[model samples]
Target: MKESDILSEALVKIKNYIAANKDQDAPIVKFRTPADLDKIIHFTVDTAGVSENEFLDLLDKYLEYSVHTGNKQFLNQLYSGFNFPAFIGEIFSTLANTSMYTYEVAPVATSIEKEMIALMNSYTGYSDGDGIFVTGGSNANLIAMFSARNRILPDSRFEGYDRKVKLKAFVNEQAHYSFDTAANVLGIGSKNVVKVKSDVTGKMIPAELEKNILETIARNEKPFFVAATCATTLLGAYDPLDEIAAICKKYKLWLHADGSFGGSLILSDQYKALMKGIERTDSFAWNPHKLMNIPLICSALLVKKRGTLQHNITDINADYIFHDIDEIEDLGKKSIQCGRKVDAVKLWFAWKYFGLKNYQKRIDNLINMAIYAAKKISDHPQLEMLVPRQSFAVCFRYVPKFKTDLNQFNLDLREQLRKSGKSIVNYGYIRKSLAIRLVITNGELLEADMDLFFKNLLDAANNLESKCQLELEIH
Candidate 1:
């Protein structure tokens, strides 16, 4: 077969896999350690490349061992499923093989990326503001942090942090770890990233934020930034944005909304209320790969002021490559890195394919799914919720009878589900206790899926409990 035939076969296999999530026999993830995977697929280079048939065989083996993220049973991460239209656009972009940094290289892709940023900014209330797409949510937050650093202490960009001021920042205790990473990367140190107290629901308490800022100031530290989480990772809670905005305004701090996990609330009329006062933020990070259901690595950083992202104002021309043109058309300036991918095309095409109304409905449906799961968890005698449901993730724990060390037993149950290829979920300790975090990110998930999740969970618990009791009997 020709290479085209092989490509066609591979694409068809992928398309079928994307649509075959409902297949019960389909594995969520095939368990293999590093040693096992290394044995299955050797990575040593070959001077003479493998033939088309060999490549096809390798693809088959790769798919057999890979985690099926689009599978209905898969509920392990912030992004759960696939978007077909977005995937098609991604394939097109991949074939186009163009970078989006400059119009000279990829005019159409650069245009789409700018236009997509404009669309996102329109909703974000950035009047004359601008935005750029980073590789992922983490980088989006980091860029926002740098922008804040540059704008807050304008001299720091030139003189560096030496002898200027003790720069400090704030985020809720439950905010993404990217904030700590940002602080460390910016030379502010993670210790300078003051973690304000969060409420029982994992929402950052605005009053506590004010108190922390006061304490930091008392210690002669300048608090320059505050990040309000839209949906925390574990609890999926939205921090009180209105209260935080007031505090930011009083302190003259840069307010950033880390909306990577829950920013689609902007599209929903009813659900967007969770993110009320979001427009007042100085910068915002939203990941379409998450709630927007776009493909991976589509994240945007939006700034309230248009020119805040301009790091270098000196006119240094590269006439041989890029002429002085519409700066708006050339996104390479706003970006932190060169040779950026055409990440916006897939998201723009996906947004246009779904339109605003349908997308809003999808967000509403996802929120409803979380509510449904929360109700199920509440009603089930064998399950216990760790916190109130604030967004599309329901964090809970399996309650076993006789009250043995439930965390380990629950972990065993999760392993059973994994081994059986019946369902996939995640568990970790939150608030010094083990909890299962299930995010409702799959657009195709239904009440029936929730039922299946609960059923499998119950069966696993029963079996594990029986084994434990048998062990006790032997002892």
Candidate 2:
């Protein structure tokens, strides 16, 4: 076939595939494992030949097989649904295929990314700031920690921390696991990550953080960075950023906020107050993909100081790259990555398509839905809530009226739900008690869907109860 014919055929197939599977709805896989990798690989690659038609067919099949999170019922993870404008922007980005390293190569993308970063800085209350797009929240966190590490100990990048300083970092126990992972990857021992205690609602205690900082200093350890979680993973709790910033200021510690899950709320009037004092922090990690409903792998690391990031990660003399530019510097000098994608375009498009007011309304809708869900769970006779809804996640479990072994019952119920493939709700243990967690960050979900979720959960529990009773009688 001619090249034009191939392109035309491919476009037609893609359009047909998307049209056919756009409205298909189903439950997400309640439990996932590599149970049939051989079959999956065969079906995905071998049976589906490399022809354009075959590839489009395979795409359609996979779309149908996967969870319809964009449907109004998906409340599984931090991210859900697709924004139409953002999707269009993503398509444009793919067609452009520009990297943000040099203006000569990606002039438009470079300017757009700089503008996007500046807008984000304004949202975080940082007037003069700089940032770079990372792969995701984890990579963003790593870059933030790396910047902090390099800022405090400039010699360690060359001499290695093994000989110069035993660097230590701190995070609240409720902070995301990525902090520990960052420390480990940065050669700062995970043991040095001081996990301070949180209150019942999961907000990190300011006094506890101060105490830990002093204790670490007393022990002759170099305490350089303190990471605060704007919204925790488990319960969506917002740490006391103002108080934490005050402490960090007093101790001269670099403060970073892991707002990857919660920073999008900066647009919401109801929840923006929770992120106060964000400007005082040295750096922040925000993921538009989480709550903004943008495509996956869109995260940013914002540093308060303009040139701090450049100081930490500047690379010069690439000969072929970094040629003289009149206006904007090459983004590569400040980014942890060398070749960066045009990930900011989607976010910029989303923000532009939905004005700030509309975006704020969307966020407010999710928060209100979360509050309503929490109340419904609390009012339910058989359900017990672990923590109140702080942002958009409600942690709760099915608790029977007369069960002394609630933990065991909850754990078994979670397993039964997982095995039954009815719905996917994760389980977590708090204060030695097991509880089911329902996260409601999906922009597409509604109160009616939450009603169905509760109904399905109860049905699953009832079925499990009957099975348990039958087993007891048989034994």
Off by over 4 Å in 2: 1-25, 29-37, 40-49, 162-164, 401-408, 415-422
RMSD of each: 1.7, 2.9
* Candidate 2 residue lDDT tens string, 1-475: 5668767866676565445323323444434455653445335446534866555556555654565556544566788776878878998998989888888888888888988999889888888898999899888888888988988888777677763477878898988888888999998878878999999999999999999988988878888999999888888989999999999999888999999998888888777899988889999999999899998878999999889877875446786887665866888888777888899999989989998888888888888888888988878888888777788788888866444478888788877665554566777777787768777776656787778778778987887777777766797
Best by lDDT: 1
What lDDT is reached at residue 337 by model 2?
Answer: 78
Each candidate structure's TM-score, on Cα atoms with residue i matched to residue i, is: 0.96, 0.91
Candidate 2, residue 75: the lDDT equals 61
Candidate 1, run of 10 with poorest lDDT: 312-321
lDDT of each: 0.85, 0.80
Clashing pairs in 2: none
User: Which pairs clash (backbone N, Cα, C closer than 3 Å) in model 1?
Assistant: none
Residue 239 C-alpha lDDT in model 2: 91
**Number of clashes recorded per candidate:** 0, 0
